[model samples]
Target: MYWSLITGMALAGAVTALPRLDSRQGNGQVKYAGVNIAGFDFGCATNGNCNITAAYPPLQSLGGPDGAGQMQHFARDDGMNMLGGTLDQTNTGKYDQLVQACLATGAYCVIDIHNYARWDNQIIGQGGPSNEQFVSLWTQLASKYASQQKIVFGIMNEPHDVPDINKWADTVQAVVTAIRGVAKSQMILIPGNDWTSAQQFPTKSGPALLKVKNPDGSTDGLIFDVHKYLDSDNSGTHTECVTDNISSAFSPLADWLRANKRQAINSETGGGNTASCQKYLCQQIQFLNQNSDVYLGYIGWSAGAFDPRTYELSEVPSRNGNSWTDSSLVKACLARKAS
Candidate 1:
C-alpha cells in the first residue's frame, strides 16, 4: 500500500497528513516488490553523491498489480557508524533526493545504512565504535527524520564478528533506545549480527537480537531484518543455487518467527537470471507468502547508480541510458502476488 503526499496545509508543529501506509497489516501483509538503491554501499571509494532519480522509475514499475510502492535507499558508508561523525552535507543531500523522489512518486522509502559487518575492515564489536558511539549515530539519524513516518530506519546493514553475543544485543538495545529517546515514531528494522541471515538465526546472534527493546518498554514497532540467497553456500556471491536450500534453511526461520509471534522481512534476497534461479525465487516467495503472519516482505538484492547487471543480485538489469530494461527478475517478484 502506497500513500500520496499532503500539501496546502500549515499548522503549528503539525506533520503533513498523508494516508498512513503499513506494510505489516495482519496476515494480509502487502507483498512489496522493492529494489535496493546502491552506489553508496561501496563506502568511501565511490562518489559520495547518489543519482537516486535514475533508479526510481524502474523500482516504481516493480510494484506488482499494486501501484508504485517502497524501495530501500542505501546511504554512503562514510565511517559515521564507526567514528560517530556528524552528518555530512553531501550524503544528507543524497538522502533528501531519495526521500524526495519517493515522496513525489507516492511511495515508501527505507533508509538503509549500508555498513555491512564491519567498518574499514574492522568488525563491529572487536575494534570499531563502542556501543555509545553507535548509539550516537542512530540518535542523530532518528533526530534527523523524527517526523517522517513513511521512512523506515534500518539500524546497521549487517553487523558481524562481535566478540560477545551479548554485547551485540546490548549495543542494539542502546541504539533502539537512542532512537526512541529522540521521539521518532518511525519503524525500525533490526538485523542480527553475523550478516543477519536466516541461516544464522538458530545458532548465532539472532537469538540475542530478540532481547532488544524499545524505550516504550516493548518490541511493538521493531521488524526483524534478514537476508537469504539461493547459492550453494546460501551467500549472495555465487550463481549456482542449491535446489533444496531455500526450504532447508529458510523454513526453520519461518517456523521460529511464527512460533514467537514476531514479524520479519527478507530485505535482501536474489539469485542469477538463470532458469533455475527463476524457480528458486518463485519458491522462496511462495514460502514467505504461506508464512505471511511472520514474514512481512521480500526485496530483491539491488539496482542503482553503480550497480550493473553483472552483479547477479541486480537481476541482470540492462541500462538504456539512465533508464533500465526489465528482466525475468521482476517477473519472479510478481509471481506469488499473481498466484
Candidate 2:
C-alpha cells in the first residue's frame, strides 16, 4: 500500500545503496547515505495512474522547486552521494529529468518501480502482469542506462501479501537476467515479501531470493533490499518511535548476511524530527555503521517534493536564502557521518 501522504506540491526523491566493496574494510562506516526526494511517484498506486499533474515536477529549469538543487545540496552540504525517491514509469520524460539531476550530483540513483509487486493491485507473475512483461520493463530501463555506472536497478518496491515467495523469486530472477543482458555490472536490488520487512527478511524472503542467480550463474552485483520503521506499528505514519528494531530485526539479519557473504541495504528508513525519533533513529544508524560489513548503507524516507513546514516525517532540510539547515533527525541520525 502507498503509505506516505502526498499533497499538491513538489516532492521528488530516490534512495540508492552504493557498492559495499569500497567500504567493507571491517570498519564501522556506512558507504552510502542519503534521503528520498519524492515527487514523480506521487500520483501512482497499485490500481491507478500516476497523476503527473498533482506532483510538482522537479525539473532542472524550476529553481525553487528545483529537484536537482535538492540533490546538489545533499551531496555538497550533507556529504551525501546517493539521492532519489520513486519513479513513475509512464512519465518517462520527468524520470529522465530526475536522473540527469542525480547524475550531476555524482551520486548513485535507484530507479525504483514503486508498484509493490502489483500492477493495478494484481501481483506480477501471479495474476497481474506476466513475468515477461515485468522483464520487458527492466530490459527497457537497463538498456536506457546501460552505461551509467551510478544507476542501480531496484527491481520492485516493498512487495507484500504474495501467496508464494518462491514464485516472486522466480520473477525477480527473470528481471535480473534481463537487466544483465543490457547493464552487465550494475547492482540490482532484490527485495523480499512482507513489505521487504527487515525483521522478516532472513526467515521469509531471504532463502528463496538467495537462489536467484545472474545470467552467468553468479550473484555478482545482486544486493538484497530491506526497509525498517521505528514506530510502534512500524507503519511510519506516526511521529513517535517506540523501538530501535535491533534485536527484532537488524541483528539477526546481519548474522544471516555475514554467513552467506552477502550484503544488503536499508533502502528506506526514517522518523519524525522529535526527541523519541532522534534517540532511536541515531541508535539504529549506529548499529548499521558498526555492522557495515553486511549492511551497505541507508536512505532516509524523504526530502524532495515535501515541504518541511507540512510533511510530518519531512527530512527535507530547511533553506533560508543560501543557507540549508538539516532537520534534527537528519543531522543527528540519517545524515550522521560514518564513525
What lDDT does the true structure give each of the candidates? 0.53, 0.77
Worst-scoring 10-residue span by lDDT in model 1: 2-11
Candidate 2 Cα outliers beyond 4 Å, as residue runs: 1-25, 46-53, 60-64, 86-90, 337-339
- How many clashes in each structure? 0, 17
lDDT of 2 at 148: 87
lDDT of 2: 0.77
Each prediction's TM-score versus the true structure: 0.74, 0.90
Model 2, span 1-339: residue lDDT tens: 235322111111232333444424348877778887777666665443345456656554543366777777778777776775522556565567788788888888877877678866788999988999889878888899999888888888788898899999999999998999988887788999998999999999999999999888888878899999999888787788889999999999998887777888888888889999999988998899898878878888877776778787888776678767788888888764421
Model 1 residue runs over 4 Å out of place are: 1-31, 44-86, 307-309, 316-324, 334-339
What is the lDDT, from 0 to 100, of the residue 291 in candidate 2?
Answer: 88
Which candidate achieves the best lDDT against the true structure? 2
Q: Write the per-residue lDDT of candidate 1 for residues 1-339, one digit (tens) a residue.
A: 000011000000111221233333235432344555443343231112223332222223332111111221111110000000025676465445545554444334566665553455555555765677777777877787787665666776655555677877777788888888875566677878666777787568667878888776777768788877788776676765665345566788867775665677777777766677778787777777666666666666654432353565553345444343445755555322221
